[model samples]
Target chain A: MDFATLLQILDSALRLATPLLLACLAGLFSERAGIFDIGLEGKMLAAAFFSAAYAYITGSVWLGLAAGCIASMVLAGIHGLASITFRGNQLISGVAINFLAAGLTVLIAQNWFEQGGRTPALEGAARFQNITLPFSETLAPVPVIGPIYSQVISGHSALVYIALLAVPATWYILFRTRFGLRLRAVGENPAAVDTSGVSVTGLRFAAVLICGFLCGLAGAYLATGLSANFVKDMSAGRGFIALAALIFAKWRPWHALGACFLFGLLEAFGNRFQNLSVLGVDVPVQLMQALPYVLTVVILAGFVGKAIPPRAGGAPYVKER
Target chain B: MPKWVDVALIPLINLALALAVSMLVILWIGESPFEALAIMVKGAVGSAYGWGYTLYYTTNFIFTGLAVAVAFHARLFNIGGEGQAALGGLGVALVCLAVPWPHWTLALPAAIVGGALFGAAWAAIPAWLQARRGSHIVITTIMFNFIAQALLVYLLVGPLKASGMSPETAPFPDGAALPTAHDIAPWLGFRPSAPLNISFLLALVACAGVWLLIWRTRLGYEIRAFGHSEPAAVYAGIHPTWIIMATMLISGALAGCMAINSVMGEAERLVINSVQGAGFVGIAVALMGRSHPVGVLLAALLFGMLYQGGAELEFEMPAISREMIIVIQALVILFTGALDNMVRMPIEKFYDARRLARQRNGRGTGVAAE
Candidate 1:
């Protein structure tokens, strides 16, 4: 590929990776706190619908973002009540929330808008605009790195920068902070954390709510920033793809960025080259699309390296007499 | 404390709560809950035509629900019913299309084996991974669902697309067609186009077979033993690997049999999205039914009614879309599965309070009798 083409693909890659990165970090927080969330998809979908719905209604992107986060947090709260408060099966609760989001989004969309479960497309300030870095124009006349900076790094929605910035933020919070240490301890062994005079339930719910907040950003980026309107099931399988990326990255923040970016690059290539071939043999695009899932399955099966989840994950905590 | 209360009363209360919440949602949508409920009831059971569609959907759920229930008996969760049923559709297509049959009687047996084997094969990989490598089946199964969809879409749009226009296979020959409701119960004057077919009887047989296998056989005893306590089952000479694989196979096969109803029986062609959300519905059914075959049957019928009635509601009241059924289904799962603890604890506390009051009244002899 030419450098220009590669840069274009990279630009799209960055755009695509933003949502995955945010959702992956969201999963990282929840699963690190011993909460297995298969409902990430549903949560993102709810946020997507609400963000678009609100953005279209109020014509203020900030309100839409706030509404998105609150909507996602509500579902996160439901997950907390079911799994933590009631001590029910975490996986079952996640599954129910997913269905809840999936059904409620389309139902509410159809009720409010008569256009078949879709909000009217947003234009102008109701949607996120691409942000060009300050030096983008000045560096345009330089060498290869100039155009790369201008095209790939400079021009992206603000959410993309936020997603990129979150990698470091997550690392700092998860490894360098007292709360992060407690959160990790709660996931690995809640009883130990409880014995240390920390409330295990409080830390876990905090992690879950933070997860909701990040997912809110991701979903809003999709509807209002990426595509301009909410489409039915618009989150698609990206949440699962994010989960797969989280597992592939072994639950590390920086590694999550790499994994999501790589998956995004694959999608970019698939979209760019519809009739891709390798060594005189045709390669189906579906294979590329399915790679994240296939890779996660392979990793989980221990065919490559082991990817163990949080030690206390998927189990509700109970105090023994 | 009582068997009937645990089995019947708690589920009733949970269902009532789910319906109440659903009604509230209807009211929020600016519709009359009572009117919607009346329309749904009248549409689902008021006529032979409604019964036909309800039973058709009931048959689909029966196959998938039993699949989940048998696996639940072994303490295994098989959520790949969607993928398995998709493969089952491929199997049915091959059986009914690849070879010529003089009549559906001959084709039915062959299609059943084809569907069961394909579904079982798709499930075997995840089962083996879970049993041998200690990989979680939940992760593997959900991933396999995405892979299955990708694979089927590739095939349907490429090699399997016989019509060259749509992403579907050519219709099977007339001889391969299953007998519809009108063929058997013409006296009732059901709609000729209704999809209630001979596969409904097959679904009934599957329920009976699953019941016998779970409660009446040695393997069933082993399965229940394993589910109750792994260490004890192992001590009793039960092979965990065998139980896991065998239960999953049975589960996948049952999920596959659903193709007999939806794919070959209804569509008469292999199409993308043939499984729809029936596989996930099976999870809700199995949970609501308490993993019992009889319970699965009842839950399946309830869902079938919702599905048929939801369609009617969508037609009669365009404002209330068909997705309302999905919202109701989600509520049922939320109430009956994840939040059941919320429902059960209150009832348990009530029973405990009553028992305590009885003991305080100098009727403590009743406790010993219990």
Candidate 2:
């Protein structure tokens, strides 16, 4: 491929990677805090619908972002209430949340807009616009790095930058703070954390809510940044892919970024090339889309080293008293 | 609490809560909740037509529910029902189209084996991963669901499409079509052409077989023992790998058998999205049914009614919409599966209190008599 084509592909990869990156980081926090969240897909779906609807009504992308986050947070709260306070099975609760979001988003959209469960398209300031980084115009004359810097890196929507920024921020929060220490402690052994006078329930809830916020951002980016309107089941299986990425990353923040980007690059490649030929045999694009999931299965199956989950993940913490 | 209460009352209460929440949602939409409920009930059971659709859906659910329940018996979450059911459809298509059979009687048995085998084969990889490699079945199964969908799309668009505009295989030979409710129930004076077919009977047979396998067989005892306490089962010399593989194989086979209803019975050809979320719905059904064959049947019927009735609501109300039905179903799952203890613990406490009072009364009377 030409250098321009390569740059275009890389550009598309970054855009596609943004939502997955945010979501992978979101899962990192939840899983590290001992909460297994399969409902990431659902939360993102709900946020996408809500953000689009609100942005169309209020004519402000910022308001749309807020609405999306709040909607995601509500679902997250329900997940916490069920799995934590009620001490229900975490996996079952997550599955129910997914069902709830999938249904509720479309139902509410159908009722309010009456356009077959889709929100009105946002325009102008209601949608996220691509940003041109500083010195991009002057740097155009530079040889190898000019197009890479301007075309590939500079012209992404604001959310892409935020998602990229979140990786380092998440790493800092997870590894360099007292709260992070307590959170890791809770995941590995809640009993020890509880004996240390830290509230395991509290730490876990915080982690889950933080996950909700990040998922909200991911969803908002999908609806308002990637596209101008919300489509039914538009998140598709990205949430699940993010989960796969989280597992592939071994629940680390920086590793999550790398995993999500790799998956995103595959998706971009699939989008660019509908079919590819390998050694004179035709390979369909579906196979390309399925590659990440196949790799995740392989990783989990210990073809590589085993990917261990947090010790106390998927179980509610109950005091021995 | 008694076992019966645990089995019956808890699910019933949860179902009531889910319906009540659904009613409130209808009210929020500025519709009469009572009228909506009335419409749903009348639509689902008022006519043979409604019953036909409901039963057709019920048949699909029974297969998938039994698939999940059998796996649950061995403490395995076979979430690959979606993938398995999809592959089952492929199996049915291959068998029905391989040769024009003179009779469905012969085609049916071959289709059953094909569907079961394909479903089991799809699940085998994940089962092996879990049994030997300690990979989580839930993740692998979910990933497989996406892979299965992609596979179906690729085949239908390329190899399976029958010189038509749509991405679906050609209709099977007439003889391969299973007898619908209109055909079989004529002697019983039942009319109204619904998709309901002889597969309903097959579903019931599967249920009975599952009940026998789970309760009457030694394998059932081993599965239950393994589920309840894995360490104890291992100490007792049960092989974990063997149990996991065996349970998942049965689960996948049952899930695959669902294609008999949708592919061979209703559609008479393989079509994309023929499974239509029934695999996921089976999770809720198995949960509400407490993983018992009888319970699965009952739960399947309830969901079948919801689905049929939900379609009716869409036609009548227009405001309630189809997605609302999904919300209602989600509420049911949330209450019955996740928040089950919200109702169970209170009832348990009530029963404990009653037992204590009865014991005190008996002891006091004995002292007085002495």
Candidate 3:
């Protein structure tokens, strides 16, 4: 392929990867603390709806993003209450949260927008503009790698930069900090953390809330940066894909970034190959669309190395006196 | 203080909470909450047509519930029921369309068996993957659901598409179509107008069969014992891995039966998205029923009623979105989970109290006897 075409594909892939990357980081934080956050999809959907609506109304992308994060946090708080306080099954509670968010968002969207199941499209001021790194114009004269560097490496929504930066930030907070030690302790053995004078509940709740914030930002990136409008179920299994990435990466922040990008690349290519049918030689679009999910299953099923989760993951710990 | 009151309290509490939440949503949408609820009640159970629809919906749930419950009994979570059911439908549909069986008697059995085999094969992959690799079934099954959807869409829109039809297969041949209520009414002495079919009977029979399989047989005993404690069961000479795999195969087969009810019984053709949330709904049914055959049957009916009612609310009250059904399902799951948690706590507390009481009483008796 030509350099320009390759650059275009790479840039598009990066934009597409942005949402999954953010969601992977979000899932990383929660799972690291032993909370299985399967409701990431619901949080992302709710955030995307609210952000798209707010952006369309006020024409301020920042306001829209803030609203998205707040809305997602509220849902996350409810999940915390249900699973943590009530000691409900973490998986079931997460599924319920997803169902609730999906239904509620569509219900409100239909009522308010009367657009069936989509928010109003945002204008220029309400959407993020692509960034051009300094001296890219001077470097544009070079052949081949120049376009790849300028277009794919440099130009992207601001959230793309944030998602890339979050890998190290997440790693540091999860491994190097005191909070990280306590979080790990809670996941491994809540009793030990409790005996060590750390409130297991408080730390886990904080982890879930941080998960909510990151998922909200991820949703905002999807609606505002990737697409100007939010459609029903627009997260479109990306959150679940992120969860898979988290597992595939063994719940490590930096590794998850790479996994998310890999999955995202597969998705981007799948979308691109939709209309490339040759005479009497063709691959169905549905099969291509199914690639990421199939890959997830294959990877988890030992096409890759063994994946080990946190010891106490998905268990609700209650101290025995 | 009454025995019946205590026994009935949890379901009642759950129903009340579900109603209240639904009513609040209806009110927020500027609809008459009471009227909407009445419509739901009437639509689900009050009339013959409503009953037929409820029963029809329940048939699918019952099959899928059994699918999930079977795996739960073996302590294996089978979340791939959706994919299994879809594959089952595809199998049945393909058999019905392609098989050249001249007799209805031959075609029907062949199609059903074909569906079961396909579903069993599909589920075996995940079971094998989990058994061999220690991979989590939840993630594998969830991924498989997407793959199944994509495959179904592709087949419907491509190779399997009927001539001159749009992304849908041709209706099954007369010999292949499931005998509906009208078709069988003459022999059974029932009204010809009902929508209910023989699938309900098949579902109930399947439920009974499942109960017998899990309660009476040697295999059932081993499966249940394994569910209670895998290590203990293994020590007792039961192969846990083989049993788990067996449970998944049975579950997937039952899920295949669910797809048959929709494809052969109702639609008379396989359509993309025909499973339509039934697989996920099966999870809630299995959970609410606590994985018992009888309980699953009853819970499936309850969910069927709610689903029918939710649809009725949309037609009678346009102000409320049909999405309320999803919200109600969510509420049911929430309340069911809460009730399960509540029941466990008090039971454990009671056991603790009884143990302590026995210890003190034993000490006093020993002193007196001495």
Q: Top model by DockQ, which number?
A: 2
lDDT (CA) per prediction:
0.91, 0.91, 0.82
Docking class of 2: high
- After superposition, which runs of candidate 3 have C-alpha atoms over 4 Å from their true positions? A275-282, B1-8, B186-195, B342-370
- Listed in order, the DockQ scores are 0.81, 0.83, 0.62
Which lDDT tens digits does candidate 2 get at residues B1-370? 6777888878899999999998999999989999988899899998888888989999999999999999889988888899999999999899999999899999999999999999998889999999999999999999999999999999999988999899999999998989889888776545645899999999999999999998999888889999999999999999999999989998999999999999999988898988999999999999998999999999999999999999999999998889887898889889998898889889988887777776688854433332
Model 3 lDDT per residue over B1-370, tens place: 2343344555556657766897798788777888887899898998766777788899999999999999888878787888999999988888888865576677767877878888888898888888778788877888888888998998888878888756889988887766676676555433555557777988999999999999999888988999899889989999867887888889899998886788887887888898998988888888777788887999999889888888887788765678888888777776675334554456556656766676688854443332
Residue pairs in candidate 2 whose N, alpha carbon or C atoms collide under 3 angstroms:
none
**lDDT for position B226 in model 3:** 91
TM-score of each: 0.98, 0.98, 0.92
Per-residue lDDT, model 1, residue B368, is 38
Clashes of each: 0, 0, 0
The lowest-lDDT stretch of 10 consecutive residues in candidate 3 chain B is B1-10
Better of 1 and 2 by DockQ: 2
Interface RMSD of each: 0.8, 0.8, 1.9
For candidate 2, what is the TM-score?
Answer: 0.98
Tell me the deviation in Å of residue A82 in model 3: 2.8
